[model samples]
Target: MVKWVLALVGYFIYRFPGAIAGYLIGTLIDSSFESNKKSGRKGFDTVFTTSRSQNVSPSDFELNLLSLASIVIKADGSVSQTELDYVRAYFVQAYGKERANATFKTFNDVIKNREVSAQRICTYLNSRTRYEVRLQILHFLFGIAQADGRVSSPEVSQLSSIAGFMRINQNDFKSIKAMFVKDANNAYKILEIDKTATDAEVKKAFRTMAKKYHPDKLQHMDEAYQKGARDKFQKVQEAYETIQKERGF
Candidate 1:
């Protein structure tokens, strides 16, 4: 309809030689407007699709995280308010206050249903998320397990199972576990070194571990994941310090 009206207007104007220029000008204006309108609709569709895709990605990530947390919290055959509180604080710290309540509700729903498969969730995350990001999530799970000042055997087992499903290396899994399991006694274990190693060897181990677990290495990650890496980084630093202090280095 608009095109026909524009054509008729152009035709009438073109009938007067003096106004031929006017007809051409009017046609050009109409054509430009029509082009812009189509482009505007295309731009809107692109933005809408991209926005929806972005929203789905983050929600999937959050849901998977909450599911894994529920698995860890319930692994000990019971739940503690302390652990729940720690998880809530973790969510708030990672996503900010605006998302805290909604995330907690999702956590509650996952726990209440009791049907969420930790293996499946971990598998999905392992495939979709970056390797370092998955490692950070494992670090966060350990923090949750230790929130009550103790990491129970069942919780450790659950963690191990999750790591396996995530395809995390056995050595990497043990190194992260050492950071949280204080009962392991050997700071060397945390650094993935032998107790009989020379001072030089220990220093090298510390540096290597430090580089591997440094939060700065993960700065490009989501803020929450970077925060989780910070916890691991601190533990690695503590372990190195303890070894140095004990050995009089």
Candidate 2:
């Protein structure tokens, strides 16, 4: 039915040149919805736009840290080396080698520091990046996670949390998350509990996860294992928060 309607509209445009003008005007009106949402400019101002302001600043650690969380999401509730490697590559490009390496190392330290919370990651980034840039960064994360042609539940859960921290609309977040989930399993599924899990359950899960991925255990393994452990551990914390929102606890 929609296709038929579109075909009829096309025929009308083909028959009447004046219809082309009307069609263009309609397209402009339709596009205004998105523009209005972006600029917070409404019916009148959008029609007669004034000089627009622009801000170009690099995204802060918060954005990077949250983006890093997306890669840490896994199928078995354990992040894999593939995810860590992706993060390393991303920061290397985003921050450049030397600064990116230092920033990456500092982020790992912060995750391991046991003094900072995942919440701080968003707070820090929110302070540093423009609202539009934060959204773009979040979307870019979805792109990275999907680059391998597969996305897991843990990643989706983390993406949802990051979106929440950014105050992104639920509908919009779902739309973006959907773009990356081309295969089976999702972040919520890997967590093995619904969003409605009780606070006690969340705590229990976090503790079990805490012991499993603790960097301390990986210290005797190899440098790679030890280096990745802390970041993976931080992901466990993020997973717990994802559950928290579902339960409203």
Candidate 3:
């Protein structure tokens, strides 16, 4: 996070003395991290898991997710480096860098080489995780698919299969899908409504979806996780506003 802030500040002040300030601060922060590297490694366990992300242990969740991610990356019959980096970056942002590094070491050394069963993984998750968390995971997967610019047909098909295994509702799945795939009726699709629905029904659907995708559903996770959740929530808001503007309501 500090790295991002320093980079942003440096970008804005590239021609000014403020860039010097950012560089100095980043140097100090980097040195501090180097000195505390041992403690950071030792402290990975505490930040790796939160008691609030369902009853699934951190290791279990990380393993299952990496397995699924590997499947998604291979779905298009070709792997893209951008997609791989998106997954790595997401983990680094959501968990601290130390724990994310340990998890990815497992991912590269073991999980990526195995044939994982989506059925077993989803069954475990479906039984253990809440609907909201499952939805968030689906959203994350879609983000991965879109990382390389477009969500391909094969990736969407793979995601659909995964969502089915996870017991995600078709309408709910479509709602998230519409966020990535542009279409004329995306606003209606996002709220799980139809163009023929009455204005009252549109308003009702807005409220329903607003509650479903609210960022508070992910309050227990990292701010990065909640920020991702807010993307969905914000999509719902934008969809509703789009409909209202169209209908002049």
The top-ranked prediction according to lDDT is: 3
lDDT of 3 by residue, 199-235 (tens): 9999999999999998987776766678889999999
Q: Could you give candidate 2's per-residue lDDT for residues 1-249 as a string of tens digits?
A: 222322344445455553454344334433543454587532222221213432212222323453345334342355445655676776565445654454344344333222333456666455544444444456666655665657666667767777787776675465345435532323343244445666787577667656755677544322433445555556556666666675567
Ranking, TM-score, top scorer first: 3, 1, 2
Q: How do the candidates rank by lDDT, highest first?
A: 3, 1, 2
Model 1 per-residue lDDT tens digits across residues 99-209: 455546523644644567887787666545556667888898998999999999999999999999988888789889988886545587878887888999989988998
Candidate 3's displacement at residue 161, Å, is 0.8
lDDT of each: 0.70, 0.49, 0.77
Clashing pairs in 1: none
> Native-vs-model 2 lDDT?
0.49
Candidate 3 wrongly placed segments (more than 4 Å): 1-54, 109-112
Question: Each model's TM-score?
Answer: 0.73, 0.41, 0.77
Error of 2 at 228 (Å): 24
Q: Model 3 Cα displacement at 211 (Å)?
A: 0.6
Q: After superposition, how far is residue 173 of candidate 3 from its true place, in Å?
A: 0.5
